[model samples]
Target: MTASPSAARGLAARLADGPVICAEGYLFELERRGYLQAGAFVPEVVLEHPERVTALHEEFVHAGSDVVEAFTYYTHREKLRVIGAVDLLEPLNREALALASRVAADTGTLLAGNICNTNVYDPADPASADRARAMFTEQVGWAAEAGVDYVIGETFGFLGEALVALEVVREAGLPAVITMNLHEAPRTREGTELPEAMRRLADAGASVVGLNCGRGPATMLPLLAELVDAVPVPVAALPVPYRTDAAHPHFQALVDEAYPGLPSGRPFPTALDPFTCNRYEIADFARAATDAGAHYLGLCCGAAPHHVRAMAEALGRTPPASRYSEDMSRHVYFGSDPTLARLNLEYGRTL
Candidate 1:
């Protein structure tokens, strides 16, 4: 059976002319606004202040984001169960879709249904896999009903979860993009090498497939190069803004995990110290990723509107009018400073 026009109008066509700029760092932005608690995360903000969510979406669009992603990360049933707010699963997802759609309508940005990690997709565990599939199925259905322009599965650490998300979106007859959160060793947390894993996601019918969120551009460049060589589809590159290497990658490396011990009661985004990329570094990565064949250029955790605006400008695309200029010199990191890079220390020669 043929799919409807809405379902068939995939991301491929929208991005055929050039890379589509997208960004979804709402959780980080909300935490900065003091809208989220330690354990509650983003969903709490969605329930209490949907207006804030809508406002951020608008902000991103104004900053040159072509897509406004629904804030569905951490709104899953299992995640809500951890905070004793399991009853809010449907409401949270529905509200996020509503707010994102509203912003898209107001700003003329595309609405993308965003799904992320499950923290329980173990390939070794069948029941866990089944549950994840069910979760993706339900969320994809909701996104389709809400009329998202496309659906994106991002920040996944395990290949199993990413694949399931891709499969579910494909089955739902929607345009889908799946991006894994891979760091270190050229492999996923599940130990699957990314080249093979990316191929699997593409072959499994992801309209676009690649990596995002585990590490910053410094580390993701090599992985994205490998992905461009492996996949036939358009690639996505949405690394976090902070510093990273394979050794200490993942934005959570800055955070103390709630698992092996007492809950820190620490807010969602700790260690957000500005040891991060300025707009120039982000733009450098965007250009390299584009040259390396990434067609979807964007930012992940720790990203702000300035970063998006820089990326849009770097691609030679006109950024949104809400911001006039990039002002790269404002950040020493983005500025032309040989001293900050410390060449003398590396080579032991001032000259």
Candidate 2:
């Protein structure tokens, strides 16, 4: 299942040029579109109306993402099995890839086949490991056959499972981008420190590795600095768009404790999500990420196309025409950066 030499060369040439905008947050976007359920997370939208999925890819491409990731986050076979739809995994994944491929090629973007935390990985159990291998192998087989530019394995919580994903993707002959879902502690739930995790993933053959899915940019900056210094390879980040200030660096903790409402573990709780951030927050985060040497920057859950536009502008790049184009007239309200007012000439300074 190795990639053809020509394909390898193409990928290498793209990387050599520079970093790319790899926007994600598909599950959130689809849910917002009313195509997928929150608790179920079936991704049946791909099978029922693939045009919806294609339209999503088109949005990211328009938002200036150089990589149109296939929206197959929860499309894994076992996730489908939960709703008595195990039979749909192959078609779901393949069709998702097909739509992404068309969008990528048509828009001059790279197709990134997507995989995620299967939640079946167990470090101490051999049978659990076997199930994980089966899951990754099958998905990689499909992605490589579809000629994806590379595969992004993200939101991974367990180090053992993350390693298995990297191994499977590399064995299949496609480059791998692996990102773990990190909390304030900068360790996997399984207790592996992020620096150690980065070194291990790099040694284990992950082409690009970093953090994603949890915590906002304000909280991620410290962890990202350590990551960029630890790994020689490029780093990618797609953090959620929540306000995870220093007091509450963990989004789960905020939701679990019910920041303003009663604590509920319900997925996609609206009250729990009332602490949403604005475009300026992502712009500030992008500046810190670029300074920290993170090349692959993006948003994860709760992200919309406007956030992507802010990211592009913050990075000094012209975003491709998007439905919600970046507004030039939006003046900065306030930020950590020093500002001066020139209205009354009492204390005049440049904006």
Candidate 3:
């Protein structure tokens, strides 16, 4: 069967002429905003706050986001079962997609159905892969049926599992974007490098590939550079706020270890004090990612409306276009000052 017209405008097509912005947040954020009562990790926020969902959609659009992902991350049956809503999986997933589609239709922006990590990461068991594949297939199929423009499997920690999610989206005849989470060096917890991961996902039929939810932009760049060289498709980079306090050694250690040939026994660097970066920091990161070759840029966890606006402004000034394209050259900006690299390296070995 032919794909839907909206779906036909694949993520690559939509992002080809220029940069595309995507907002990332799970159902928990919606609940925090009083739009939901918190049933599961991916509760039915849309059912209760369709307007709020719509409002966020409108805000992103106003801020110049080209795509808004539906809040369906962790909406799979196994995840819902943890919260006693096992029976509501299909309905809830469908509803989330529908709500996103409605917002997209009303605002002329693309809607991407968000599918996140599986119930658990169990590489030793083939059953885990099987279950993940099945869940992803069902969820992607439902998203397609509900008329999403595309499907995004995000915050993935394992390449094996990410490939399973990619397969399901392809079988459903929808374009897919796989965004994985990584430690300081852009490797999975098991040490699969970001470049290798991106290559594998592209081979598995992911139309767009990127990173999300692990570390902020400061720590994400090394991996983003590797990804630009690894994949032929457009790369999207959505960095979230730092997961730990700025002074936390664990966070700093990740940054230190991600660079090539870093010593394993180096002393850890002192953590940088925390400071409010506001939209300026976000804009700087987006610009850096774009300069480093990210074709699609946006915000993730802890990112607010202003951050998205800053990204849009950065893109607007640099590209002067609104559609996605592949001919664009990836830009890289490495400064003479090595403060970031030095600090990151100092922390990299601590992990």
- TM-scores for candidates 1 onward, in order: 0.85, 0.87, 0.77
Deviation in Å, model 3, residue 339 alpha carbon: 44
Q: Mind giving the per-residue lDDT tens digits that candidate 3 earns over 1-351?
A: 222344557577777777778877544346557666543445666666677877776666666777767778777878887878788887777777776777677666777877888866577888888988878878888788777778888888888888888888888887888898765445766678778889889888888899876567666765677789889988978876443333331333443333444353321221211322366677788788988899877766556566677777766542222243222122123333344465555555454
What digit string (tens of lDDT, one per residue) describes model 2 on residues 1-351?
A: 333233544544666676667888888778878888877777888888888888888887787777788888878877887899888889988888888878877777777888888878877888987898899888888998988889999988898899988999999988899999976677987898889999999988888899888788778877887888898888887788888878777676564444434534432344435677788888898888988888888888888887887888788877765445544333343322334333423322233
For all candidates in order, the CA lDDT equals 0.79, 0.79, 0.69
lDDT of 1 by residue, 1-351 (tens): 122233344467668878998886777767877887644564688879988888888878887888888999888877888888888889889988888877777766778898888877888888998999888888888999898878999988888888888888888888788998865566888888888999998888888898888678888887777788899999999988877756666655544344334244422256555457898898899899999999998898778888888888888877664357844434345544454555434443332
Name model 1 segments beyond 4 Å from true: 1-10, 254-268, 321-323, 326-351
Clashing pairs in 1: none
Model 1 alpha-carbon miss at residue 112, Å: 0.7
What is the alpha-carbon RMSD of candidate 1 to the true structure?
7.1
> Clashes in candidate 3: how many?
18
Best by TM-score: 2
